[model samples]
Target: MPGRSRPIDKFAAAVGKCSKESAVYGKCILADYNNVHKDKCAAEFMKLKDCYLAAYKKR
Candidate 1:
């Protein structure tokens, strides 16, 4: 049987499902962390946002 889990655990699981997108976005930010400008990572951010939305819907 499936064991009960906490809200945070569920959230983490959903996020884990989108780890690739998250890593891409994270890499974009870290690529220029010191002097990052606006929209510098817009494309990556959009992908991450879409992944999160999809993950949220699946939850």
Candidate 2:
């Protein structure tokens, strides 16, 4: 597989692909950065996770 991306590179690209979702979820967490709790941002987190997985699979 000449020129194939390394796993880490693929993962990084996947993260870049989901930047919007990441930023949104990040903001949600940052709002309560000092006192994070379970499921506080579950919806946003799930959106980011799903985006990442889809992007990763596409690469």
Q: Report the lDDT tens digits of candidate 1 across residue range 5-56.
A: 6778767877888899889998989988998999999999998888877876
Q: Output the number of the TM-score-best candidate.
A: 2
User: CA shift at 27, candidate 2, in angstroms?
Assistant: 0.7
Give the worst 10-residue stretch by lDDT in candidate 1.
1-10
C-alpha lDDT (0 to 100) for residue 32 of candidate 2 = 88
Q: Candidate 2: TM-score?
A: 0.87
- How well is each residue in 1-28 modelled by candidate 2, as lDDT tens digits? 8887899988998998988999999999
> TM-score of each candidate?
0.73, 0.87
TM-score of 1: 0.73
Residue pairs clashing in model 1 are: none
